[model samples]
Target: MTRTPASRRDDYPVFRRLQTRWMDNDQYGHMNNAVHYALFDTAVNGWLIEEGLLAETGAEAYFLVAETGCHYHSELAFPGWVDAGLRIAHLGTTSAVYHIGLFAEGSGTAAADGRFVHVHVVRGTHRPMPIPEAARQVLARLFPAA
Candidate 1:
């Protein structure tokens, strides 16, 4: 497979600042690879909540991750922060792809970057459903034209 380069923070329109805990680091002296995926999940879900598209209570529809991937460019260690940048790569009726860049605080290049594809599903049935208009409106802001 062809290698993709790491993204810059500015390439994404939204960002969430996340701190690295001491426990996040591994015996190797750097943040664990699994932690990167956790950060990506947290960033996306946090943005959804911030946009009022997700609720702890009864939400119109819930999203389930269908796919996810990451490419690490550098190391992240404890005792610092990460600014996770988010953007929409593709938007579909019931599914959407989110691009995430994990940049060390104040760094211009990404330490790691990834993609997540979420499918909107019914609350009870857990079956795929069309994305709500309100959610769509919020997600559209991640697009460049918006």
Candidate 2:
């Protein structure tokens, strides 16, 4: 089967720098596969919080992870830093698909790439809700041009 080429830093519009913890490494001496998903979650949610789109508490609406996926191109080990590049692949009324690329610091090619799907929902009810206009505006910055 053919494989999609790994993404590059230039493909994403926003980035978050994250440090790999010692515990992140597995017996093989490389970062465990699960950590890649954590980094992706951190990058996207951290961006949202920084942009004032999400609140840690008492928010009327917030996002919940509906799905996640990853493709590894190389190994990432602990005692290093990673740059997670993010972009919006799809924007719907109540959900958004995020594309993330994890690259070693100062590297142009991605070490891993992944997709995260978030569903906007009411805080208490947890019912799907339209993405807030304010949040949409901020998210638009990372969306690809028409």
Which predicted model would earn the best lDDT? 2
Q: In model 2, which range of ten residues has the least summed lDDT? A: 53-62
**lDDT digits (tens) for residues 54-94 of candidate 1:** 75668767899999999999999999999999999999999
lDDT of 2 by residue, 70-132 (tens): 989999998999999999999999999999999998899999999999999999898999997
lDDT of each: 0.91, 0.92
Runs in model 1 deviating more than 4 A are none
**Can you list the residue pairs that collide in candidate 1?**
none
Clashing residue pairs found in predicted model 2? none
Q: Residue 85 error for model 2, in Å? A: 0.3
